[model samples]
Target: MTTVESKTTSAEATKLTVPSRPGFRIGRLSLVRRPFKVLVNLVLLAALLMLVCINIGRGDFPLSIGHVIDVLLGGGTRIERFIVMDLRLPRSPTGVLVGMALGMSGAVTQSISRNSLASPDILGITAGASAAAVALIVLGGGSAFAGVLATLGLPLAALIGGIATAAIIYALAWKRGVQGFRLILVGIAVNAMLTASIGWLLISADINDVSRAQLWLNGSLNGADWGSVWPVMSAVLIVGGLTVVSSFTLGALRLGDDNARSLGVRLQLRQAALLLAAVALAAIATAAAGPVGFVALAAPQIALRLVRTPGPPIIASAILGGLLVVGSDLIARTILPVELPVGIVTSALGGPFLLYLLVRSNRKASA
Candidate 1:
């Protein structure tokens, strides 16, 4: 064969031997597209929408799904609009944004730690936020000045507390570098300390303040309003976008530290940045919804199993997180004789799941 013909044949052989990833490229931008992942996300999104409608229609008035959709699209009467828009709309969206944040946060943490059990809640991020918020509530109770501070300062306090706690955990975990096992161990210890602090604050506070703090601690969507939804939405959009962009490195990180280093991954810097993103997401979600439990721990793992990814896919995890929160909230509202906190329902679900994971892990180890 001529030189050009041989070269062409070699190129074709290379192409045949190297399997392209299942995705599309558009000039400068490319995405790894998994059809199953897309379908799962779409299904989750649809389920989330349906739940939102059902949630909006719930209550004494009881509007139908069709009516809810009509009112949502600016077709209903003023009263219907008032009920859907003014009264009930905020809670569902708030739940969704919170769920998405937790979901992504969980995915990042779990991926970084390479532990199925690693999550913001387990790592004390949620506990730190809760501690700060509860302290604000209890310390600032009874006075007009305190009430104002509690109203305005709670979210900020929670965010700061979570970030600080994460920093401490990371610092403690860092010997030569942050190992996944060390990080998780440090997180659990910190979580215990923070939980103890929260308990102490509650005990020392006034009765009424304790009652209020307890309500908040239960993680209810009882008073979620437009005001609360905006911050979480903003966090989910901005920080979440950053997390998703950074996720390209997660697969590398998951392949063990030595392997990741061999692949030119800056182990310390990348891990810290990703962990910071996870902390921010978890903090914001906790601030909005009072540390809604188990969604963070469960969502990413559920998504991981469903999509059959080596690690949790961020988008799918976020969607599943939203679905879990919305569905749990629906059950909280309707399934019982009285309204229960969303966190309670989630804990009930997550506790069993955690045990199952532990059992499964043990079995695998033994085998």
Candidate 2:
């Protein structure tokens, strides 16, 4: 038998051949291993591009899409360049940036909380920022520094408020390792109290102040120049970078405290870092876009569903959030002869989806 085996040819050797183990792939496609998800992202990107193109040419004095493209390529009339560069491009980027911040923050918060319902608004972050901005606007009327004060103080105040709220909630919920339900309950309570505070501030303010507050609350991108764009862009860049860096820790955290700890992940420190970054992002976005609610709530969940993965899906959420804001703003501007508030359009569009989520979730739980 040994002699016969030794005499075997290369072709006959296959008769007793061991199965070859599959080799590891080394490429981007191999890395993700999820082509449909990539296709979905591509579709979203395409839709967003189309929407931007359509909105660029829409106004009382509408420019052609071709002219808009020409302007983007660095050749167009003075008005065309001004409108594209000065007006539409800035607004578009602002919407996109704010949406990105909101979406990423929302994803982080919901993951950290381990509660699908946890959102920037639900955690009192947006409410805090809005309250601070409204107070500044109401109390500092008629001064040259009024806008400056509101703009500058808004993010800072929001930052403080968000940190305080998170601290309080975390402290309160720290019985046996910050359970998701407990955190969400505390967050909801804090959000309600802060929202009521905002209402009272509005109720006591003068009509003009209230009107200004209302517009801010409605989250307009009407005058989003580069100056206005930078703060938000900076916040998105800094906080976003921080989040991406900590994303692996976040994935670990999703496995629960004990498992994460066993894996050599420092639980409290990583959680604090992620939470702080998330809060900062939410605060900055809120300061920029008022309480642009529901986008934050809806975008991440939608993205997770689309991506068919777990743990925040931050990049996809950001993209979708930006698209949602820009598309909603476009609808707000064009659907009515008079422009609607961007916030109002987002709420209107997002509210229905939110209701669907709630009902579906409820049904699932009950079932």
Candidate 3:
């Protein structure tokens, strides 16, 4: 039989037969088939690239985009090199990496839960990271040891917290077996409790420490350097690799557990792998950028709506999240008279959409 597949569409379309070979298989054929989605993803990348250059050139000591490109390509004046290579280059990529990580995490999370609202931020994973990082910053001897704490201690703390929270939510949601709705409910409760704990920590800290903790809580890439960029890049590569490897299993999972099992998908193993990857990505991204809200919650859903695919489209989601974050950070830094944290801009953008999702979800449940 000839292979036929639905290129991403809101309405069903005739399956088109695409020529495929051994090296470039059906999965690769999907890339060829979904040309429109691919073009949209490319546009998002171009926008992100433009924003990166724009962000690099925007500051008190402004440089040109041409100069930024020259420095990036390894030929510029000493000051230009320092500005583009040493300073600004790291910042935009940091945002992109964090966004990609959150986007991937969100895609896996929503796909695994089979719920559109199921994101790391909404489910307490980011809150758990925030709480742990806050405790370490406010109470772990303050900025005197900030170099050591930020580089060594806090990321580790956040990862542990996220994993612990994920475990707890899974346990609480487990009745006979885990259900998506129960998992989401448990996550919401867990998120609320963690948020309250973050508030308490904020109130109890010294004023200086409060300032330091606030930066993390608000999630800024201001003055971010190579140190921050590498870990997030490493995470996006590793966890992203795992997600790509497990895509078939993930697609099987959307078929429901029994159907998945009949098709030889190791339900528990696949679920655990997907969750571990998602939790790890979200934890590291939070550790890098603080609890940058709404990117995780919105990116995959936006991608899903755009792609109209059966499962969360990870590539589109990552691109959309990166675009959203990079654009938001640009506005935060350059547009306003006072620089706002990138988180504030994202929250402003995401809040109304999130409310709409919640109301729609509630109405659906009631109906």
Candidate 4:
């Protein structure tokens, strides 16, 4: 062969041998595919499904998984349908959706702040919602007129309070620009204040009102019905969708502000947008199922480790979050003679995890 022809053939061979990048593109958006992450998500999803079936089947009238499936598929007796469909079904979905929202929100906040400790519960977003909802519950009392107002206004009040708290935290954190550590510090302070406010409200409220608000503050799905599930589902579909779509910015932000800016990321605008979405997700979840603690804090980190991703993978985090909550709810309902709130189970599990993270961070810093 001629020298030029030999060189061209070798170059073509090299091109053929080199592998392409592992993701597909859709219009302007490029999504990177990770097989391990996909497998993790699928496994998490299957676990969540299994937990849901177990949760549905185990109660005073214990049905088998097959029986639950039969009831779900519209083949069960009326009593079985009523038992599974009417009562037990709502709680699992509500917990799953709430977990998914919290998980995604946690992932966004942690990624943006570049801090493992940054989550809605720690950062006061959930606290703000809790305070607002408690205030409404206390003020409304048991009077017919006030009760109606509180019933109608509780979710709205929580939403507004969460947004307002996030705005305050952002403003306080913004010294020239919002730093991750500063944001976390500000969030912690705000959360403390909100926690105090909720306590004061509970102390000053009527006994009946306090009773109601206290149950909510503990984050129970005791009263969850189909009514509670739809709002959370809607929020997840809308705000959650927006959060997922905009998450590409998180990669650039993780590389530091100068790098992000170099990549044409409007840093302030993007941060604010992401923070807003995260806050909204947490607030809506709180409204639906009170402040289910630590799901947000734990899910993303667990998912990050599981997926072996530099940043938390949103979908994996979400699925694992669902699994965590559903499984916790199952434990809460079945393990004890008296059912406990799902939040109690999560808190019991997450408290140690949080401490472990803190200890790990401390060790790394000392090193």
TM-score of each: 0.92, 0.85, 0.87, 0.92
Off by over 4 Å in 3: 1-33, 141-152, 362-367
Clashes of each: 0, 0, 0, 0
Task: Give the per-residue lDDT digits (tens) of candidate 4, residues 49-161.
Answer: 88899889988899999999999999899999999989899999999999999999999999999999999999999998888788788877555644654766777778888
Cα RMSD, each candidate: 3.4, 5.6, 6.1, 3.4
**Per-residue lDDT of candidate 3, residues 1-367 (tens digit):** 2233333541244333434422335754543356666777887788778878888889878988898888888988898888778767888999999999999999998888888889999999999878878888887755553344466576787888899899999889988767788889999999999999989988988899899988878888885788888888998898888897777787888888798899898887788779989999999999888888999889988887887778788887887888778888999998988999899999999999899889989999999
Across residues 40-83, which tens digit of lDDT does each residue of candidate 1 receive? 88888898899889988988889999999999888999999998
Quick one: ranking by lDDT, best first?
1, 4, 3, 2
Q: Each candidate: what lDDT?
A: 0.90, 0.80, 0.84, 0.89
- After superposition, candidate 1 runs with Cα above 4 Å error: 1-16, 20-23, 141-152
Deviating ranges (above 4 Å) for candidate 4: 1-20, 27-29, 141-152
Question: Candidate 3 — number of clashing residue pairs?
Answer: 0
lDDT of 2 by residue, 215-325 (tens): 888888876777667888998898898887676777788888898899899888888888888888887887776778788899999999988877668878888998989
Instruction: Give the TM-score comparing model 3 with the true structure, all chains together.
Output: 0.87
The per-residue C-alpha lDDT of model 3 at residue 337 equals 88
